[model samples]
Target: MEEPGPVHCLLFAEVTPPLIDSHCHLDAAEFDADRAAVAAAAVAAGLATIVIPAIERANFGAVASVCREFPGCVPAYGIHPMYVDRAEPADLDALRATLAREPAVAVGEIGLDRFVEPRDDGRQAFYFVEQLKIARDLGLPVILHVRRAIDPILKQLRRIGVAGGIAHAFNGSRQQADEFIKLGFVLGFGGAMTYPRAARIRELAATLPLEAIVLETDAPDIPPAWRVGARNAPDQLPRIAAELAALRNLPVADIITATTSNVCRALPRLAH
Candidate 1:
């Protein structure tokens, strides 16, 4: 008899292989209580890797430390838009200097966020454009944090070109999705797709070419529907991938294979 593959997906009867949580914050305080155990459990849950991106100057060291502490975690460095208000010019210098020293898989968890009130569009644009340039200059892929600012984020990505990367938790239109693809980027779909009410996201996941899609947990955020209103983690990635597989009417194995490939292509350094 053929050996049964790993069974991590609740609804995806198709066997699964090791998965990659393309975006997660394993360094977040939510896991500080038992971060090591969480990392071990995620590996046991069938997750082979987790990409952790730093949100600000403060956590740069912490993110890097997490990577050293856990073989399964990789790091990305950048300034998140939500933190630009408290950021200083010197921080950009710090980011550049840090990237010089660290082996980051990408430069990110960075981009525009129109969702916040009292929006400082100029400051946001400045930090975003600058960070994009740093990523470009470093020849590193970027992990974008695009919210209601997709078009604007796309515009800047076009202006300040960098190696292709993942558009984390992408919730844009199919047209926008195509635009990202044209630029050699992959769309990340996660916990949001698990919600039946997220019709638009479901439709995109169902219809987009699998080559253009990647899996992510956006952990400690974007909790899946089954685990709604609860803390999300890297271990939730398999079920999250299963949701996408179900959305596309494909087997979990196919989703796992294609998405894992997509992520490696998006962030080449992570492939190793």
Candidate 2:
């Protein structure tokens, strides 16, 4: 039998030394078996911080626990659009209560998703609008999960007039991007750009102003090219940073600094 090909490395040799994963889901069951090890690996790999956004009311406790356990992990709370069908009416109230009691850095993993079929557009919009109110009330930034529903999301945000937040794993038009930026939101980029076919996203990343961009892994989901078939972790941030730098024609350190600062500015609680 032929020997297997040598394993490929993802990171660039002279790129940024440290990078932050502005959004990730470290509380998921995939890491339950060895979450600590995974986190340690990420820290060792130069991942400065990992922001884990809560999916629903059910996982808020787990998300909070992970944040408490991990020194550099920050947690945000919100109901995801894909799971809108599962959210109870009281869940929104619970989210507000949780935000008041818990020490979350933001309100998020919330937004619209028109990609789902037999669409529950009404339900998604209701929850999204409610959470936007919650974020506004609490004076917290929001992390949006917009997918095929940028227009509606933008409209709601404009109407609500919250300060700012992050458009996680942003995949939208340059015009949409500018609107979000104008609203003081930061655009998050992740493994999607690593794909050879995502020319548009790559171009957006290349052209967007550095200050408006934030880095994220969206780990165990949007893995970079080197870890395509495997699970993703915050540790892969260095590689992602390098890719963004290559796209933007800037030094890795510059990308790292800009993204880190942007993340802190976008999510003030992370400053601690």
Candidate 3:
């Protein structure tokens, strides 16, 4: 009778599975009010790692701070093409100083963008070439932000002779993809593939070799189908991974393992 009087029920907690968000921008102003919460949400949603790429010289500190604050967040530094006009000559020197001081996992968010007309292609080229040199000298891989400038970017990469990097948000022809793979780069797929209208991209994802593919969400930016027009986050990676899995005709677990392994190999610094 005493035991029956003290009977209690315990609730079972649902465990979330873990995944890597290989690319994201946790330092952006969009997350200022709730950065800690946002990061926690990502972790709660099973994002085990995040790679935050620096967009300008000014954001390097913030990017580094976010990495330090989060256990699995890694930082990469470079000048984004759209911000080329705002970049100062000394910014490159500043970048070099910062690189020497902080030592990021890669050099990036750097590359050309021909989509915006009247943009100074020369300025973009100068900064890109310099960053590539920095990456080469440091023996670090890069996170490329190429758009409508893949041909020229490829030319520069070939000229620099540095091996491997991630072609983030890749949307190019099969031939172009092959060229990047030949340079040891891995093609990154993201929410774009989840769109029904993105037939070519989905086809590319399916045709690309499993070993050369990586998954990303480009968080706070490229939200997947269900999240279109909403703020994207690292938590969306699982959904994106499922899209990639479907495209490649593989199971979700296999896609996760292959893409995570490919990311680790491409970005050795993230291994820590």
Best by TM-score: 1
TM-score of each: 0.93, 0.92, 0.91
lDDT of 3 by residue, 65-129 (tens): 99788766877899999899999989988887777677476788999999997799999999999
Give the Å error, residue 57, model 2.
0.5
The C-alpha stretches of model 3 lying farther than 4 A from their native spots are 1-18
Candidates 2 and 3 compared by lDDT, better number: 2
Clashing residue pairs for model 1 = none
- lDDT per residue for candidate 2 within 12-88, as digits (tens), equals 12224446688999999999999999988886787767888999999999999997898677678999999889999
How high a TM-score does candidate 1 get? 0.93
Please give the lDDT score for candidate 1.
0.86
lDDT of 3: 0.82
- Which number leads on lDDT? 1
TM-score: the better of candidates 1 and 2 = 1
Determine which window of 10 residues in candidate 2 has minimal summed lDDT: 3-12
Q: How many clashes show up in model 3?
A: 1
What's the CA error at residue 13 for candidate 3, in Å?
17
Give the candidate order by descending lDDT.
1, 2, 3
Per-model clash counts, in order, read: 0, 0, 1
